[model samples]
Target: MKKLIIASVIALFILTGCNKDKDILNTLNDYNISQQDKGYHFGDKLNIPQDVLDYAEAISISFGDKETSSLSIDPKFFSLGENDVTFNIKTKSGEVLQQDATINVFAKAKARPIAYEIANQYPHDTNSFTEGFELHGDTVLESVGLDGKSKILKYTLGSRTPILEVPQPSNIFSEGITLLNDKVYQLTYKAKKGFIYDSNFKLIKEFKYPDVIAEGWGMTNDGKNLIVSDGSKNIYFLNPENPSQIVRTIAVASNTEAYDQINELEYHNGSIYANVWQKPIVLQINPANGEVTGILDFSNIAKQNTTNEDDVLNGIAFKGDNMLITGKNWSKIYEVILK
Candidate 1:
C-alpha cells in the first residue's frame, strides 16, 4: 500500500507539470497580438497592450531584431520616414512563438492655425513666371520657369526692371532659387540637375538632384541648411556642402489631412512658409516636425490678380516686418504682416 501511494504521488506531480506547460502554450496561442497600424510621431512612447504585458514574464519582446524588455517602446528605433517595425514574441526558453505583429511609424507633428494680414503692396513684373522669390538685402532674387523662358533675375523691391538676368539653357526649366552665403543655388524641374551660381549670376557648378525626390519644386535656407520641396508632401533638408545628400525629410500635413504639391518655400522667423501648388493658401510649417501651423489665405489676391488660369500664387519673400507674395504673370507684389 505504501509503494502504491508513493507511485500515485509521483504520477500526480508529472501530470501537474505537463498541465502547466500546456497552459502556457495555450495562453500564448490564444493571446490576440496584432500589428499597430496607427501613426505615431517622433518622441512618442508606444503603449503596449495589457494582455501582452500580462504574459511578459513568459515571453520576450522585440522591435525587428532588436530585443527589448517588457517596458514601453522607444521611438528612437524608427527612422525619420515611413517605418515598418516588426514586433516579435518569444518564449522565455528562447523559442519563437509569434512574429507577425508590426507597427507603422511616421515622423510627423500635430499642427495648429496661424494668422496674417495685408500690410502693404509693391510692384512686380507681369511676365515673370515666379517659381522662386527671396529678398537678399534690398534686392529680390527671382527664378522664372517654363521650358524656353526659364531664367534668374535680380530686381529691387519697388522696381519692375531686372537689374540682372541670367537665362537658363533652353532645355532646362528652372524651378527654385536660394542664396546661401555669396552663392546662389537653382533647381531644375525634371532634368534632375541643379546649378550653383555666384551672387552675380555666374554658373559655378552643376549637381544632380538626390534620388529620393521625384522633382524639384521649391527651395529655401534657414541660415544653415538648404530646405527643398518636391511637389509631394515631403520637404527635404539638404546639406549645403553636398547638395545631393539629404540630411532629413519632413512630411507636411495639416490637422485634418496631408498637404501635397508643396511648392515655393521660404524660411522666416523660425518657421517655413510654403505655397501650395495651384492653391491660393500659403501654409506656415514648423520645420522640426512638418506641421502646418498656419494658413495664409491668398484666395482674394488670387481672384483679384487672375488674368488667366495658368497664373497661380507662387512667390514668398520676407522684407523687414512684411511678407512679399506674388504669382505667375503677376503685375504687383503684395506686402502683408502676420497678426
Candidate 2:
C-alpha cells in the first residue's frame, strides 16, 4: 500500500511540471510585437514589448550576421523585399534560445513607369529565340538559346540576316552574351560552362561557372566589368579578366515587390536595364544599389509580335540614343526612345 501511494505521488508531480511548462510556453507565444500595419521600413524603429524584452537577458538580431543589440536597420543589411531574420537570446538562467522572424522592407520611392515612343522597327529573324542582345556602333551582337539551336550572331542594324553566325554544340544550351574589351563572352544555361571569343569570332577560350551562379540567364558589361544574371533577383558583376570569379552582387527590387527572372541585361549610360522573362516589362535598375528606379512597359509592342506565351520579351540593346527591344521568335525589333 505504501509503495502504491509513493508511485501515484511521483506521477502527479511529473504531470504538474509538464502543465506548468506548457503554460509558460503559451504565455511567451501570446506576447505581441508592438507594430501596426505591415512591417518596419528603412527609417522606422523596431519596437519590442517591455515584457518580451524583460523575458531575455541579452537579445541579438540579424538578417545575415548578428549585430550586437543594434537596431540593424542599416540599408546595407536589409533589402527592399522580405528578409528572413534570426534572433538569439542569452537567458538569465544561462540558456540560449533561438527564434526566427520575417521583416519586409520597402523602397524609399515607388518605381515610375517610363513612357516611350517607337522611333523605328527593324527586321528580326523569327527563328531566333532572342536571348542576349547588344548594339555596338552599327553592328548587332546577339546570342540565341536552345539545346540544338543555340548560336551567336553578328549583324548590322536593320538587317534580318546575320553576317557572322557561330553555332553552339547540339548538347549545350547557350544563354546571354556580352561584349567587352574587343572580346565576346557567352554564358551557358545549365552546363556550367562559358565561352569567350575574339572580336573576329575566333574561340579564345572556355571557362566554368562558380557555384554562386546557378543558371545563366542574361549578361551585359558595365564598361569595365561583365554583369550576369542567374534568373534570380541577384545580379552579379564578374571580373572581365577572370570570368569565373564574382566581384559583387545586388538584389533587384521595387517599392512593393522583389523581382526575379532578370533576363537580357544591357548597361546604358549609368543604369542597368533588364527584361524580366515572360513579362513585357523592362526594368531600369540602379546599378549601384539594385533599386528599380523606372519601368518601361511594352504591352502594345509585345502584342505586335507575341503569338503565344512562350514568345515573351527577352532582349534589350542600346543603339545611339534609342532602345532596341525584341523577344523570343519575334518577327521584328522596335527602336524606342524613352522619355
- TM-scores for the candidates: 0.72, 0.85
Position 141, candidate 1: lDDT = 95
Model 2 C-alpha lDDT per residue in residues 290-331, reported as the tens digit of each score: 888999999999988898988889999988778999999998
Which residue pairs come into collision in candidate 1? Answer: 114-294, 119-336
lDDT (Cα atoms) of all candidates against the true structure: 0.78, 0.83
Query: Candidate 2: minimum summed lDDT over ten consecutive residues — where?
Result: 28-37
Q: Give lDDT tens digits, candidate 1, residues 36-97.
A: 33545556665654554454444445555676654343544543333434345444445444
TM-score of 1: 0.72
Mark the regions of model 2 whose C-alpha exceeds 4 Å error after superposition. Answer: 1-44, 48-51, 62-69, 89-95
Which segments of candidate 1 are over 4 A away from where they belong?
Answer: 1-110, 307-309
**lDDT computed for candidate 2:** 0.83
* Steric overlap count per candidate: 2, 0
